[model samples]
Target: MNAVDSALCEAFAPSGVLRVSINFGNPVLATRGTNGEPQGISVDLATELARRMDLPLRFVTFDAAGKSVAAVAAGDADFGFFAFDPVRGKEIAFTRPYLLIEGSYLVRSESHIQTNDDVDRSGVRLAVGTGSAYDLFLTRELKHAEIVRGSTSPEVVNTFLRDGLDVAAGVTQQLLADAKRLGGLRLLRGNFMVIRQAMGVAKSRGDEVATWLDCFVSEMVRTGVLRRAVARHQIGAMSAPEVKP
Candidate 1:
């Protein structure tokens, strides 16, 4: 490889191996296999990036997005997949989004909450995963509602039910599955936000690393690597369109 490429490799794998932070919090990107191994679109992309870099790979796994972000931001891992948020942007240098997943809310079937607008009224208790993208988003946007913190995204529904919160906010697909599994719950009409999922390295890695990561994601989309990975994993979220110049 050329000197510039070698320098990037050394920066990315400073400990002699690429450690990727894999978050199982977002079902669209990753999940545990029957054999208990991490499997999904994020894993496929991380593996491909390592292969292309000719670097040995390792996964630093977490069940929560907040932990994954912390690991990468602290330089405990070389890379991570996360929903792009301005709050997180302080520590992570993110690529343009590769996936667009809807952020939605779920409510009990008999609850008076009827629409997305109704969710923002006073006295409404909304449960959200602590430090999730939507939690951060809603924390900034919701004017009157109270946001109750769940330990992780997957547990948002449980927290909502356990605390008797009025709504559970999270990824649409995950909430849909939770509503189906537990019953008596319905999603609020439409979505509250569209989560822009992307790969990131710590800002400490420098602008060059962020630029290269963006190029890598763009090439994956152009060559249909992302398309195939989504199809292979049976993810329901839409692929984000390439950002035009």
Candidate 2:
């Protein structure tokens, strides 16, 4: 093992605390609270992992999921929790999924756009975070809807909030949370795509950690810890766990 891995092993050998990195952009995953401390589903899950492992926890935040995954690959973080994708799989090892989520279009409640069908019409523009999975998904699925890409979710949301686009397509979890807070935005009842969320570790790190994480995630799902966390956070877009094959 390398120095970082050796150090991590030594660190965990005594206390079992693992240093994990997660994206703060997705409120359902990790985000700063009013007190400026980290909070959210991934944060809770990380804490739970630490508890189950009889270890303390360390957290590192990134602006996006891609960044978080990159951190894992660079050994800057031990692991990451984010949506799993085939493209990302080539770069990192991923645990079996703990949760499923879908993407949806968010629109102002007063806007006439009410469905995916509505978004297919010409002249309708959908805002998305540039270079994000949502952007790629929207590009593939919505041939007729013009895409307006922003660098961040807040930028995309703000553009849509200001009427710059007819809709904003994002993860349903975030859309629902934004709807609750902003009042004017609403998540359409239907989904555009389904995504599985998993923990990612560096590809170079061998499968030991990934195997452990996968087993832990399976137990969390079976014991209702995953469900409780989602419900407690009111993450409306998350789907119930699927039985592992």
Top model number, TM-score: 1
State every prediction's TM-score relative to the real structure.
0.97, 0.81
**Local distance difference test, candidate 1:** 0.91
- Per-prediction count of colliding residue pairs? 0, 0
The C-alpha RMSD in Å for every predicted model, in order, reads: 1.5, 4.4
TM-score for predicted model 2 compared with the true structure: 0.81
Q: What does candidate 2's lDDT look like per residue over 95-198, in tens digits? A: 77777778788888888987778887889988887655677666777777789875566466777877667888877767776788878777777888877788
Lowest summed lDDT over 10 consecutive residues: which window, candidate 2? Answer: 1-10
Candidate 1 stretches greater than 4 Å from native: 1-4
